[model samples]
Target: MPHLSLSDLTFTWPDGDPAFEGLDAVFGPGRTGLVGRNGAGKSTLLRLIAGDLTPDRGSVTVHGRLAYLRQDLTLDPNRTVDGVLGIDNQRKALHRIESGEGTEQDFADATGHWDVEERAVATLDRLGLAHVAPTPDALGRTVGTLSGGETMLLGLTAALLGDPEVLLLDEPTNNLDLSAKARLYAAVDQFPGIVVVVSHDRALLDRMDTIAELRRGELRMFGGNFAHYRETVEAEQEAGRAAVRDARADVRRQGRELVEAQTKIDRRLRYGKRMVAENRYPKIVGNERKSQAQASAGKLRGNHADKLDEARRTLTEAEELVRDDREIRIDLPDSVVHPGQQVVEVADLTLACGPTVSLAVTGPERIALVGRNGIGKTTLLRALTDMPPRVPWRALPQRLDVFDETRTLAQNLADAAPHATAEQIRGRLARFLFRGNDSDVLTSALSGGERLRAALAMILLAEPAPRLLMLDEPTNNLDLPSLQHLTEALAQFRGALIVASHDLPFLREIGATRWLELTDDGVREVDPR
Candidate 1:
């Protein structure tokens, strides 16, 4: 078993905003899920632990070797599969030694790794990349030829080949198909080392032994999986709300008591003034009594004010314990379709390298498009958008590159809906959690989740609206909160929907009415349950 400890870690971006400051955590053996909202520094923390990025202050200590699989993996097109696997040199050395053309250095390079090729093949096979493993020149194949999902799996395979005691995976499931996700899940479950993963995939988090959440520059660890963390946080929030309620009541009660006490003191002062004015007692006696009354009134007022201040402090402390769980709220009644209206009519359409099929969607049918990677799910979605039916339609591509990166979110929405005014665009974007100046942010600067939200705003807020909406892997890079907002927003949409995704739980959350699986033969309807 190995341990990874972060002591007083601090890091800041070049722009001067601190991603993390004085953060500390200890991760021992077993799988740990690192979850947080977008831009919460989950990826930054992982990079720090991997030593890919240096911290501005403090240190990251690892008891054993460490390996990291980054979220965005860029490989040279000319690089071979073996090169990407990092075993090419060892394999070459072994081959040279075997062919009697090797030097002493070749033996040293290949020492203890004589079966490196075999191990590499086995690792790739375990990760569902066996198709590339068996080819005679598979190891020499160009990386550009592999699919995006296959490339991600290859990265994981390389990491596993290193056999590091501390493994860090950043959004490993992104772009992966369902089968690949399953394979990755199995690998994580069986891994004996300390595995720390930063992902938004709920399915993957459910398999973790611990859940570590980073929020607002602090790290909090919760025992068990995501489910357990959810349960614990929900319970804590409920109790916090109750405490706030009690504290608020106490403040109100103290306010009323202070007012009553002040009223009594005012009455006493008025009586003392009347006694002095009427000469009800001797001048000296009346003056002495007035001074005593004033002193008493001042003491009473000070006591009440102090009590009120103390009550307010207690209320503030109570409020601090409650979490801010705000969710997006949006309504699209204009995009709604009648029960008898035809949404989509695909007649004898042939997708690129996909099945030829005919389908019709009436009313607000929600379709879940599922399939393996490279089976042309994206192609099918594009084809549907190309030959749109009588109704207005829009397609959200997997890449989410529908917007102009140079422009702001508001400008993009305005461009999409030429008839809409700037105020209208901003108002609509606000519902998508882009309030005020947030809509002014450049699309290029937006995070993955922010970009998705901005894209959704542009599509949904366009002129005439889209009654037939298609989303291709919309959940790919979304954080948990963003995913929830997406699900909620989709649930409120009354238009026809075709959502292509590998996240089964998300599909179910949005209430998919129809399940369609794309295959080599064609698109066929199936039961998602």
Candidate 2:
């Protein structure tokens, strides 16, 4: 039976136009990709499928139990990975039994004769959490101490623990690092239930059995992976455009022929008139011939008009089809830079250690402080700005001026250069796409992409701009086009950049000479090229 089916579904958000209209699709016990451009209602569709939101019209039928993983999860600050995962001493005993370190009587004592503890440990191990770290009780830490990616994974583990019949994930790999993302994919691949993913990750989409593209409130199913869908869709659009061009050409040619025919008819009428004037008996015949010519000309004109209208309508339809099938646009901004190799020269820079740990960067280099979520990428950038030690970037005894994240565009400029006025800061902000009222918004409320842009705006626009610009996960929530623009801009930037990003494509585009791969094993520099 089908796992989840949406029949003639239609939905609209509170403010926007309808997102889906008469959309229909079906998922079986395998992986499927729900792909669309940014703001294409992929998230909303996932919610509907998960039964968190109901369609405004039509029916969403579920033949089996469904589980969903949202992009962001807010967990209590007091729970541990073990508590959240339902793993305890009992579970540990079961693990021992499964590993043959304990007997069946021990397992019975642990699970009250259920023997489900071993099964649970095996399941968790399969999800790639088989580390032999000390228990959280021993560490005296809660889930709140875990990294963002770890917390997100814990949520997924909870969802999977129920053993649902279907799994729905919405951009599950967004904030995860390479290793966590790999583990998530492995889990999805091994899952026994249907997997429906709403994601923009082309890599993940490669594993999908089918791709359902959402555009202009319509769903179009293709029988292959994302690459195949891309090829087929582009080909179809090209064929449509070609058809329109041919039809237009035919209409133009037919118009020219019709005009020529009319001209011939007019010439023949004149000749007949001349013949009538030469012989009075031929006058009546000439008049009849002229009338016949006029009738034929009128008929041709009417038929030509009809054909032209039909051709125009056909062209309109073809253009619409092409537009609907076209790829989404990503408008990437160019990161600006001035010549002079010394963008940032940090010598013995140490980070703060309250909410953030300390670190040192003592070189003029384009670097990346790569790590899992909440591992001080932001802290390092903040030290460059010298904000509150909530997450400070403590510079070690150096004449360092940081481009602060806590300060507004205007305020940051004033702080960076005390004499800089508000007007100058506003002008600079405008150049960075923070125009008019946008520059006034508080830094804390800004979205991830917006904050990154704003930070760049304030710094790059400043007089004697930062030689070393630091960015923290610059592409976290940015849509594709914006990312492309940033990529292009960074490619042109001559100054040093220290960016923390998991987006390999973006890193490559920005032309990082080397990458600082931060893992559980520690930080190591490698050539990512």
TM-score of every model versus the real structure: 0.90, 0.73
Give the per-residue lDDT digits (tens) of candidate 1, residues 282-327: 9999899889988998999999899889989988988888987444
How many residue-pair clashes does candidate 2 contain?
13
Best by lDDT: 1
Tens digit of per-residue lDDT, candidate 2, span 1-529 = 5478889998886645577888888877788888876556777788888878888899988877778887646668786555665555555676677688987666666755344444445554555544412332332246655555666676787678667888888777766778788888888888887888877677788888889887777878888888999899889889988988987887787778778877877787787777778885566777887788788878877887777778777778777767642222222223333443333333344543233233344333456556665554555565555632211121211111234556665676566556667887676666555677767655654433445455555445544444455666566544555567667776666455677777878887787765776544434677675
For residue 190, model 1's alpha carbon misses the true position, in angstroms, by: 1.7
lDDT of each: 0.85, 0.64
Question: Which residue segments of model 2 deviate by more than 4 Å?
Answer: 76-79, 82-125, 129-140, 265-286, 324-365, 371-375, 387-469, 476-485, 519-524
Which consecutive 10 residues in model 2 have the weakest lDDT in total? 390-399
Predicted structure 2: lDDT: 0.64
Q: Model 2, residue 133: what's the lDDT?
A: 25
